[model samples]
Target: MDLKRLNYFITIVNNKSYSKAAEKLHISQPSLSNAVKKLEHEVGAPLLERSTRKFALTDAGELLYTRATIMLSQMDIMNKEMKEVIVGGKGEVVLGIIDSLKTWLPKLIYNYKQSYPAMVFKLFDVLSVEHVKQTLQTYKSHAIITNQLIYEEDIDSIPLYKERLVAVLPQEHPLSKKTTLSLADLEQESFIISTEGFQTRIDIINAFKEEQLKLNIQFEIDRFETAVSLVRNHLGVTIVSENYVMEPIDKTVIRRPIDHPFLERTVYLAYMKNRHLPVAIQQFLQSVEEHFSTNKPL
Candidate 1:
């Protein structure tokens, strides 16, 4: 079947309604139906079960849909590569990174450009482990730089560096007097831990549990800035990766290193293990490995 019909079929399946797919595709309903009909005719088997209210894909249709999705993705990539070649545009290194890497990323890109001038960088502030995993899987980012571990089988991870996790406390907080703080020291302090789904939340929870300390969580946040903001206001204490507080330490909050092995996080460079990466992206991955190998952010 032609790409157009396969696209129409996929759209219909995604929308779960022929009329909705037609509207989305900006085509007449009958025209969309005719395209599906032709596709089924070409396949010599009914692709959809007409008896169901919500159309169901037949076995043959399921196989075709799976294959077509991959084929279309490859075709789209081919078109993008062709256009880039025509315009003398090298592919971009699309990276999803945690917030801490914000300052040095541009420098990394600038330095990489010294070797490969044509390639460009696209950076996304992907913080949570779940968000970064989805970003890589969806091809929204070619790779990810993060500290959290990704247990997914399809993603390949390169260990970068271990960053110390430190506590952000209000200057006036009792524990702020200490040079290094333990979970025991902050047991009674109002805690501002990360939200439930984040790996940081899990790590912090387990760290407190291991110390047999009660985690008095007063605030749950997704952003480190929010944690810092709350800590600055003396609302609660929060822990963060040291890289996040490296520069621009304001007077309101005090950062003290957490004195536990579990408090340290290892930064990682992660990418889809099985996907065919573009040449520039492949080069970028290599360059990233080399860059981190020499310059550990820790």
Candidate 2:
């Protein structure tokens, strides 16, 4: 299969218009259309549903698109590795990490850098596990550190650490003195929470549902820091990973563990299962394993 045609198909799908894809690809609209038709013939199926006003992919098209994305990503990695080999330099490793890992990820990277001094890094602080998975699938990131246990055929995940979730409250709040909290305790309080699609947010919602309670959500923010800051201001209480409890926080806020059954989540380090991982990535994975083995929470 022609990689160029596959790229054109991807561009068309992304732009959702033939003319736009042609313009972006610096080719004529007719030529682009013809190329797609040829591609469809080669694949023995109509890849697109062009009869409707809005463009849509056929079932076959969706499959091809998914596979082509991975294929192109692999090609890009191979090309970069080849270039690095020619230049006699270690290649780069891009990592996508969730916000909760911010505290420890730097130290892990620092340790890895000692072993692979010439390796370069690109870090993406992603908001959710979905975004991290997408980054890895698109080849924008070589590995991801996330709290969500992703079960995908092409992806492999290793458990790194487990942490409980706790309710963060203003020090002056009545619940601040409590050793443990429950969903009922927070039912009347205004809640500061992560936006939808985040695993923490989903877990919070589920915990509320389990107790047959409705949360009085006041704000939906992206980062844990924002949620914590809001709680510190007494705007609303929020739930956060226990890792934040270990951080040096403002005296105005306190964290209380939720009652049984407790809300605990495990963090995982994930990567593509089939990709030929570079030495730097392999060593970095080792560093992560070593760090957690010696330093994991009890």
Candidate 3:
């Protein structure tokens, strides 16, 4: 019923022991028990079941715990926002980024710090695009940058840039001499494609499916570097974003743009549609936009 009861319930559920929860909350065990009892009474269902050896949540308890976790997080955010507003000198922003963006985001984050000097940044390197979307919805990250975008109706996406997909091929491959190649050129070659769960792999699959083409995959890899390495060793050809294959590419390998051509993946800066970005976060976003605009990677 009250925030105190909800907090007590959550702590007890998380710790899974009345005595441990009481110690963590700095309250007496009896008080903790009474608070949990009051919560269960208000909800009209038993929240926890205890045996001699262990404790576990009932179905109702599981649902309540999930709801309470989200509520507690919102409360924590509200408290932090109030404290920051009162203090007037400190702020924090969390950014979830894909691995491909890691090469450029560090410099952008560093520039943001130089300008603000008091803002704190929390960066999470995420592999899944869906996970990035979930993170934004849960308020875990204020914004996300990724080459692949999921067209969610409730999310606002800003077009950062379109990155050209390039082919990494072994030195002796006949098409390696070309300046650019198309997906059709890959028909003769066995591809070293990204694994099925990756966003890039999904995009590649969908794009090929649209053209009624199926990839002849020799191997599937999880990381861009791994795929590229296989190509370097004359294993197979790979298609990846240009940013991922910067200088010092292997001597046995050659890179060429996909010009003959499929659609270039448009990278986006995505955030929740109705969310109010804090001043520091807005500044950081602006800085990222400016960086890409000014430094056109050819």
- For candidate 1, lDDT tens digit of each residue in 133-249? 888777778889887788999999899877778899888877777898888988988899888777777778889889888899899987888999999988988998888898877
lDDT leader: 2
Candidate 1 Cα misplacement greater than 4 A, ranges: 81-91, 115-119, 152-154, 274-283, 295-298
**Model 1, residue 85: C-alpha shift (Å):** 5.5
Minimal lDDT window, size 10, model 1: 80-89
TM-score of each: 0.88, 0.81, 0.74
Give the candidates in order of TM-score, highest first: 1, 2, 3
Please give, for residues 1-298, the per-residue lDDT of candidate 2 as tens digits: 9999999999999999999999999999999999999999999999999798878899999999999988887898788656655544377878877667767877767777787778888877767767877877766777888887888888999888888889899999998777988889999999998887788888888888888899999999988889998998879999999886668687899988889454788888898888766655777877787788887543
Error of 2 at 55 (Å): 6.2
The weakest ten consecutive residues by lDDT in model 2 span: 80-89
Give lDDT for model 3.
Answer: 0.78
Residue 140 alpha-carbon offset, candidate 2, angstroms:
1.4
Question: Which pairs clash (backbone N, Cα, C closer than 3 Å) in model 1?
Answer: none
Q: After superposition, how far is residue 207 of candidate 2 from its true place, in Å?
A: 2.3
